[model samples]
Target: MDLLKFITAGSVDDGKSTLIGRLLYDTDSILDDQLEAIQRANRKNDDGTLDLAILTDGLKAEREQGITIDVAYKYFHTEKRKFIIADTPGHIQYTRNMVTGASNADLAIILIDARKGVVEQTRRHSFLVSLLAIPNILVCINKMDMVDYDKAVFDKIQADYERLTKNMNSTQVDYIPVSALKGDNIAMRSPNTPWYDGKPLLEFLETVEVNQQPEVQQARFPVQWVIRPQTAELPDYRGYAGRVVGGSFAVGDRIVALPSGVASTITRIELASESLTTAESGASVIIHLADDIDISRGDMLVKAGEQPVLSQSFESDICWMDTRPLDVNQTYLLQQHGKTTKVKIQDIVYRIDIETLERTASDGFGLNDIGRIQFKCADPLAFDRYAFNKANGGAILIDTRNNLTVAALMISEPVDH
Candidate 1:
């Protein structure tokens, strides 16, 4: 079965985790012991109804505070497909956690409380979904039960959201009115909303293709390890081991080693010790180059005609994730597509006002602040624009001093010289 990686995000108490719990519950994907544990937590619920949120709010602090403190991942599958669900936090302070969950997601389900409509967090998340370039967006207008399952309410909120996301870069935007608590429009249709005719969320998830318009990125692989198992019988076993970050690699394909400008053909491809003619994106495989070029960890292999941008400095949009203010004088480490190098923040171009979609002068990015910044890497970075491919363009900034991640970097369009 194919797999889908998705994340759920929204404001605190907007039922993001509960929606996931309801989906898992109605799908019968929960185990007996897990249900028993939830049943025990249900006894503490204010109302007689069970607290389905406990299923995903697994952290003790989350359960105690009734909030999601970190990104909790859950896995389940139906006969149709498998899924990896990332339940992200909703609070503004936890924006870094949300970004981490969204970096590699194929789709996102942004929950909107029916009574509250679109709030600040909703806009921030929608913008991030665009920045992260998540293709499919399912805006779940949740808590319909509290809103009396009113179609008018859903319609109005949908209109407001459309206006808010008019400038976003998301490819597809869809909506559903759901009552995560009552299980309406979750796994099964609800007659309460006779005017609405969309399929249930789970049904949509099962049927819809998350990568609706797949970006055909050029084959790019960053060597993670050099495998040279010197078995006396078959000695020359120098293979470059890494996961395919973009496109596909196949035997006999003309490939180029980046930063060094060495060219060669793929001599062999191995997956789990089995030889293969081709390895697609996200595949973990060992590749052997014909020429035995000077390739090593952090060096990328790509199609000769479709090489990624190689530059020592590039501009990008950055979400400041550190607790302290960004320090321009401090050098940070930039890691992208398995390659790491020391980088310096050269300039802060501007900060974005997500609410107004305005760019204003800014010295440095503060926590949760999105800004355009220039970075000079110690070595050449092979990257694509985030809009072209997320895995190709997404990177993180690490503080060399403490080795803590301080920012999420999404490379913007490269300027032509």
Candidate 2:
């Protein structure tokens, strides 16, 4: 079965954690021992009620504060498909955690409290999802029980949310009414919501076409490691092992190595126990070139004509992950694919306001700030626009002094009309 990776985002106390816990419980995905543990915790904290939120509050700090501070991942599978949930924190202080979780998500679930309707955090998360270019979005209006399960209330919230989404550039958005605390309209549809005819949350998740996004337009394989046997039995064995970031490559396809500008044909593709003729995106394979021409870990292989732009300077939108403010003159190490190079921030173009999506010219960025800026690298880096290919277009900045990942970057060029 195919796997679906999704991230959950919402305001604090919006029932994001409870919704996930209920989904696991209703779908029989939780083990008996795990359920017993949760029951024990619930009984201990009981004031005549079961704290279903305890199911996902795994961290001690989270359990004590009743708020998620970091991304909590959970795995479960139904008959139709498997799921990996990235339960991200909803607080403003933890916005960096949300960005990290949503970076690899194929879908985003933005929940809203029915009683509170659309709040500031709802807009903030929706904007962040749009900024990240998450392909699919599901707007779940939670806590319908608090509103007496009224269809009118659900309709009003839906309308308001639709209006709010008008400013977003999302391709697909869905709305569903649910009560996570009571397990209503989660895995199974609720009879109480007779007026609501949409499928349950789990049903939608199982059937949604999460992989319908466009395929890579260009093939890119960055060499992560090189395998060479020294023994006589396999003395001449040589292969470049890496993951295919974009497009597909076949055994006989002609390819070129970047930076060196050398051409070679793919002789074979090997996996753990078998050899394949072709490799597609997300596949890890060992590629044997027809002629070995000094390829290393940082080198990239691409089709001769479909090569990415090579440059030492480029502009990108960055999400600062560190607590210290970014210094424009400071130098950092940039890691792309398996390649690393020293780079200096040349200029601070503008900082984006998360709430309003407006650009403000600034000298530096603070923690969790998103902005577009230019960088000057020590050597030419091969990349594509983030909108075209996520893997090739994305990079991470690391502080050389502390070896800390400080920011996530998306490469882009100024549009020419």
Candidate 3:
């Protein structure tokens, strides 16, 4: 079965964790030992039902304070498809954790409390989801039990959400009413909402179409490791091993090593011990080149005719993840997959106010801040705009002092300057 990676996001106490727990419990994905442990905890809701939130609120701080502090990942599968659920923190202070968890999500389930309707955190997360360019979005109107499963409440909230996201950059937006605490409209449609006509959350997830790769099919292989084991058994073996992050590659296809601008043909492709005639995206294979051109780690291989922008300067949308305010003077380590380079922040064009979605001049970014930033790299690098190619356009900035990731970057385009 193919895997579906998704995340749950909303304000505090919006039932993000409980919704995940209900999905797992209803799908019979939880292990026997885990169920036993939950029983031992004896956590239950006011309705005397077992508190399913404990399944995802794993941290001690979370259990004691009754709020999620970090991103919690849960795995489960049904006969139709597998799932990786990221139960991200809903508190405003933990917004960075939510960004980290939602980075790789194929779909985002933004939960709304039936009682509270749409709020600031809801707008904040919707903006982030749009900014991240997640393929699909599902707005789960949760906690229907608290509101007596009223159709009007669901309708009002759905209308508000539609207005909120009317100008947002999203490809697909869907809605479903659910009561995670009572397991209604989660695994299957509930009779409680006789007026509502829609598939349950699990069924929708099983059937949703997810674009697995970017639209562009230009092959990109960033060399992660150069294999040159001079052992007698394989004396002449010189292979470049890495995961194909984009497009496809086949034996005899002409390729070019970027930055160096040297060209060669693919002589062979092997995954582990098996020989392959062609390698597609997400495949980790060893590639043999027809000619040696001093290719090394941090260098990228692409089709000879097609080229990604090679430049030292670029514009990007940056989500500042660190508590320390950004210092434009200090240089950082820009890590793009296997490649790393020294980079400095050149300018802050504007900061995005999550509350109003307005752009304002900013001195620098702080924790949970989203802004447009211009940066210059010490060396020219090969990459595509994030909108065009996700595999090549995403990167992270690391503080050289502590090696802490301070920012997540989404490249817009290479700056001519």
Candidate 4:
């Protein structure tokens, strides 16, 4: 079975955790002892039933406060497919946590409390789903039981959400009415929602196509290490080792080393002792080139004539993840794949108002603030526009003093200055 990675996000009390727990409970994905432990905790809902949210809100503080703070990851598999679910925090202060979880997800489940309808976190998380370029979105209109499973309520919320996301041309959106507490429309369709004709949440997830479009694919190999052993037994053995982060690499294919701009053809591809003719995305292999070139760590290899934008400055959208405010005067480190270069914040164009989705003038960004900015790298970097190819376009900014990652960046386009 293929794997699907997804994230759940919404406002606090939107039932994100409960929905995940219900899926695990109804699907029998939870262990007997684990089920018994939550039961033993005796955390019950308003109606005196066991609180399923506790299954993911495992932190004592979270259970006591009834809110998720950190990102909680859960894994389970059914006969049809395997899943990795990230239950991210919903509070405004924890928006950075949501960004971290959604970074690698193929799908995003933005839960809307049927009782409350569309709200701030709805827009915030939706904006993030678009900004991160998540391919698929399944908006789970949860707590349908609270609204008596009325079809009107589902339709109203669905319409409002559609209007909010109509501009998201690249993302595919779908909706389902669900009462997570009652195990309806999650693992299976509920009789309560008889008017709904769509497949249940689990079934939809199993069948959804999250594969990347092959037409946009391009090869990107960031050389993490260059191996050279001048032993008498095997002289002049040189190989570049790294994981192929995008597209594929085949032997005899013409390639170029970026930043160096040297061209060569792939002589061989090896995985440990085995030789391979080709290596696809996500494969870690040592590659040999036809000609010895001055390649080093932090250099990238790409297919000839399909080179990424080479520039020392670029525009980007960033989420400030640190407590300290962004300072344009101070120098930071921009780490893109294997390359780490000194970068300075050239300017902060604007800060996004999460609730209204407006770009407002801002002096600086604080924790969890999302905005548009420009970066000046010390050396020319090879990167694609984030919307075009995420594998080679995403990067992170690290604080020079503490070496802590301070921001998540999505490259927009290369800039001249």
TM-score of each: 0.92, 0.91, 0.94, 0.94
Number of clashing residue pairs in every model? Answer: 0, 0, 0, 0
Reference-based TM-score, model 4: 0.94
Candidate 4 residue-wise lDDT, 172-257, digit = tens: 89999998898888888889989999999999999998765443568999999998888997598999999998889999999999
TM-score ranking, high to low: 3, 4, 1, 2
- Tens-digit lDDT track of model 3 for 1-417: 799999899999898778888998999988999999999999999989899888765564654676535677889999999999887777776777777788889999999999999998898888888878898989999989889889999999999888878758755889999999998899999999998898999999999987744566889999999999999999988999998978899999999998999999999999988899999989999999999789889999999888899999999998898889899999999999788999998999899987777889998889889879999999888998887887789999999989999888889988885
1 versus 3: better TM-score goes to:
3
Give one digit per residue, the lDDT tens place, for model 1 in 1-417. 899999999999999878888878887889999999988765444556888888765564754675635578888898998999988777788877889888878889999999999988998888888888888899999999898988899999999999888777746888999998888888889898888889989999998786775656689898888888899976987999998988998899999998898999998999888999999999999999888668878888999899989988889998989888899999889988668999887789899887776788988778899879998888988888887777778899999889888899999965443
Give the winner by TM-score: 1 or 2.
1
lDDT of candidate 3 at residue 10, scale 0 to 100: 97
Better of 2 and 4 by lDDT: 4
Candidate 2 structure quality by residue, lDDT tens digits, 36-117: 8877775532236566677766653654676635678889999999999998877766777888889888899999999999
Location of the lowest summed lDDT over 10 successive residues in candidate 3: 60-69
- In what order do the candidates fall by lDDT, top score first? 4, 3, 1, 2
- Model 1, residue 167: what's the lDDT? 74
Clashing pairs in 1: none
Counting only residues 3 or more apart in sequence or on different chains, how many pairs clash (N, Cα, C under 3 Å) in candidate 2? 0
Q: Clashes in candidate 4: how many?
A: 0
- Candidate 2 global CA lDDT score: 0.86
